[model samples]
Target: MKLTPIGPAALVLALSAATLSACGGGGGGGGAGGTDAPADYVDGATFTLGLSSDPGNLDPLMGAGSALFAVTQFAYDPLVSVDGKTGEIGSQLATDWTVDDTTVSLTLADDITCADGADLTATDVADSLNFVADPENQSPFLGTFLPVGAKAKGDDATGTVTLTLASPSPFVLNGLGSLPIVCPSGMDDRSSLAKATSGTGPYELTEAAPGDHYTYTLREGYTWGPGGAGTDQKGLPAQVVVKVVENETTAANLLLSGGLNAAQIAGPDGDRLEKSGLSAAETTGLVGEQWYNHADGRVTSDPDVRMALTQALDLSELADVVTSGRGGPATTLAVNEPVACPGDSVSGALPAHDPDAAASLLDAAGWQEGGDGVRTKDGQRLEVTFLYQNNLGSSGDAAAELAVQQWKAIGVDATAKSQNETTLTGTIFGAGDWDVAWVSLNVGSPDQLVPFLSGPAAPDGTNFSAIDDDDYQAGVDQAMGMTGTDSCDTWLDAEALLVQKADIVPFANNTVRTFAKDAEFETPGQLVPLSIRMVAK
Candidate 1:
């Protein structure tokens, strides 16, 4: 399952610093916007960002159903923010917080003034929570986000909102972080959160002129923020106009041609970026991997066979064909993220390379090489059909083709097929018609991984592996029900358990980047730069 967002989980916990040097694409020109003097803003500096896909809908509360959720961050504020770079809790609408096992008390900042100049309060936070939790919203990601029993309570004066959880969940804060607070004054009707709407962030969303462009004007005299970004960007870019360039090639060409400042580039757009003097930024995320359906009662259910399959493929070689030392192999979903057990962190959870062990594991599983160079057991061919979407960009295609060859070399009968975006989603992700599929799934939280990885969900669910191992499910259950851990032991243990299952093979995590042609702006400091507040050039 290929997913997106939150560039490197570390930005929230660490610093965006020089992370841009890792992805090798996109660069910005430097200049002053409003910092010098809000009134004497640069005559020609306008921060124009680009989105490769159309933001389907502008409602953040609508969940991840459309690409628009990412853009909605431009005009919305979540109760909390999970620092992508740091993996720690950071304030957004909430100023401070206190968390026990199942309850979280948030002290909402009183100084917040929305675009409408209405004083933000705890009551506004409650209203936002209720909006997402409303069953009528029909958001596919609602269950994983709002859940069933979570509640918000508090008053507007003190600006305190208390979140009560039904269980100890590692994702309670993250879930809140994902929830965007709407204006309570007119929030009773969701239509108030319109495209050309108002928000309280550093920049006020003045226009979302469908596809062609969107604009944001500085919220004059605005000073309230939750820290990190909220405090750092004192002066805003005079105006930020985001342009929609759906083609990566055109977007990259414009960035290189000095037309636009920065554009997110994937696929062939990255081919010449390394030598283009551009920075490559990235962080660990929902890595694209090879998923084998074990619960479907295929040969993949055999533990040794799974191990052998792992041994047969050479990830190092695969990386070679991937991005010239840019791709890092993944063994599990959260292998790249920092996780603690109870009191401390450990490195034992990292994925390791073991070519010999992989070959041996498969051999022991009785998948011997047949006369035709294909592995077989009792006349059954060791074959699995893998599905991949062609539009994901060059990296996805190159990665899929490499996977096919690697698996075939090990006597595994593997074939790669390309499908369009909608058809692929309907057939493989939705219909579960695939045996083994290579996909990328990136999100803000690792706990929400359940709805996509395991657990019972509507319409076939995201258990792409079709694996129903009790042991594996137990680890997932424990990971999902955690609040805070002082160490990474249990987290690593669960990660190892999931990796050993071999139902999902995490190969590499890519970067989400932005570039600018003018100096009046600074890096957006977000995986999807527009999601978090943007600092002016």
Candidate 2:
């Protein structure tokens, strides 16, 4: 598949880190009449999902969670959309889009209407995007895409709308496809999203009680749907209900007991689930991670020491604990999943890990093995501290901790610091103060990784390891300038360079899989879920 240079965020940010503590406390009461068949025309049956955390927000812009996106498949509509099955661009709200030598114009669907019953148009799209892009709003994700004041004016000639870009941004299609249209009603640049539910997608949000459950029903008489509704043997669920049940073990148990339709089981449990009368489907998980923070200064800056450090840890052990051997070992930030950096697969001059070679390099760099067998240079001990967060959710801490064991076996003094949410988020990530911290970032797509690992991204600029390389930066910039197949090749080359330099360590390409019993819209393995593929059973 041809990947876009500018991809979606790594999917990890959308992961469920907290549970529905309050819940308005809905009873996991069995559905009335317990019929296997749903009582709706589209969805065969209303399915109940056990999510790892509560819905972060109903606001589309601030919302996080793979399940939230699953529900939003109904509420909002983007100008361009991808095919869930093939990652191909299919029409939804936009009937067609045209690109000039520099400018791009999008044609909106005539059938477009919001849940508030407002007719969606180009004006709404422009207004909503501007709201998120405004400096005052301070949207966390705004920096990932077009910069502030990026989306310029749009003109409506008769019935069609044309949009102009600030510059020749090749990622325009990527930006437009993900930016959704919002209603102008009760909206301002600094308005609070108390009950902001105005979108033009498959389903309308009936109700959402934060820290509780979310209920969404199909939009009646909806004509604009993605792909065919369903196959002869398959049907879309009439309704999609998501409730937060944080315990991974509980998620697995409920799935086995048949009380829950499908649940995302992590690590060892996933293995048990696959073997226990359950089917498996995975998306390329967005969680990109690495060990970093030499700024605190314990000599992680030494190239040979850093290389040796990376070589010491065994990924197979990490994978065994984190994914239960379900996914492959991650070697670079951008794995070969949809939305991966086009540069991730590019050709490079980096060498793969060789323990013997690592030891040789360390020795050559003056790391003389001491009495304790620990390499020491200038009387400094070869050691580092690793930090991570995911107290409530799966952070693969077990794997990271076991990696501590592996490094120790390799004669390296490494300690794993599994932190509490406040400490991890506040001290490590928030303060940028640490020795070597381990963290995972899931951007719905690999393109999302460009900003996280790429240097000097707008606003917050997260190139956490502070790996500032001119050649590597140029490669990423070149990829950003590309739109089609060449973009992929450029990104692949950049990825190779990153691997060679050991800028970031890859652990595993998240399979993006979640277990579901109902199979409402049983899509093949994918990273981002397109609103178009959702069917009404």
Candidate 3:
């Protein structure tokens, strides 16, 4: 499950370190019908979901929004489906799979058909894999869901798809489990995917309006759902409407009014809903992270400057500010479930906050404190730009401002700016005018971070940070040989090495909560569409 970016400040700019107080008052009812649902609830009814942001693109490969990922599951099926809570692998399009070093083979299910009514063959599966595997495709999942340079070959007669990796992958099955397979038509026409979908999943995209709402209809005879959930299941909403309602207050109101069946609410609004007897499913992941720009010409390119900038702030305070004091210390990049690696990489691994040490580090690096207390080296001010996503809510904005002030105290001029996810991604990966950024990329495995952490800079790769860590690379290489829980220790070691170098700082981990209003669904991060069961209403 992917996390919707989260961060701290109140809806207002008060830097109060107060833990969240209880809700102002209880909501309108004894919950959306207590233990028993309304008698009118039907399996074919529409389930309306309220989302905080629009999933701009419907394409599973391109979209980063947690909503998009959840909705994608409704339309597309992975070769293997993983249990969101447990690290258990289940069948979807592929009934079985096996791995031997660099070679991973999968047995495709023969009964599956695309939304277009075309048979979903092993060759189509291979094409989908190869498409994302090709660097020319420029998929963000190139090194994420599927390793770049990996080749796929399908045997049409035998219903088998073989993935030959360029290198041994540590959590290859986990990667495959997250990959959403596309049919030939969707693979051939990329633009169509933004508006429509073609895959063998529980639902088919019936309508989409980009930033407004999307409607999906259940596909009949979809027995290959994650853990064998089928369209024939009782209480399954026949039509799912994913509506974009950015304001949490408005969403909470909708939930109370029965205009929506489910919504993910955080912060104060969540507290209010809980008091009203609404139950929430909580999923915890890193939501506050600091990444230094390693691109040439950026002040953060200097290692000492990066270290100094990182050490300048009291991280615990920053975490509190970002989470509105509702978060814990981040432990690992593998925050999403079923987490491929389970270990604490933050506790003693990340650098502690020390302004004095930061100032001394800058001084030793030839940056002298100027008249205004800002540092200067070679006539250039020790200035850096901090970019973050505005959708991370007010808390993120406050945290960014707080970080800027902290940097200032350390004689570093830091500018904080917030952009929408699209603009933020462009600025970090395309515009390349950033010095540092607060971007939390939550993936299931440490290997999923490889392309983003170390490799060619983006446009070509997701390595927006431009990291080149020999130790991290060595650790990843060693981890690839091990599988499942066996690779956890090595993956943690690799992650720790990156943190030790101050390449990135993941500070806050929050239990992001989603409130269900007349619909029952489990949230690993986003509401599982197939898991949704409309209560009788």
Per-candidate Cα RMSD to the true structure, in Å, reads 6.0, 7.2, 5.2
Error of 3 at 397 (Å): 2.7
Please report the candidate that would top TM-score against the real structure.
Answer: 3
For model 3, residues 161-192, the per-residue Cα lDDT tens digits are: 99999888777888787788998889889899
Query: Model 1: per-residue lDDT, tens digit, 202-230?
Result: 66677777757878766655544445344
Off by over 4 Å in 3: 1-3, 7-41, 65-67
lDDT of each: 0.54, 0.52, 0.74
Best-first order by lDDT: 3, 1, 2
Instruction: Pull out the clashing pairs in model 3.
Output: 7-395, 7-396, 8-322, 8-395, 8-396, 9-395, 38-536, 41-536
- What are the per-residue Cα lDDT tens digits for candidate 2 across 158-231? 33555555545545565455555666663543243434366666566677776557776666545544432211
Q: Which candidate is the best by lDDT?
A: 3
Better of 1 and 2 by lDDT: 1
By summed lDDT, the worst window of 10 consecutive residues in model 2 runs over 16-25
lDDT (0-100) at residue 475 of candidate 1?
A: 69
Q: What is candidate 2's local distance difference test score?
A: 0.52
lDDT for model 3, please.
Answer: 0.74
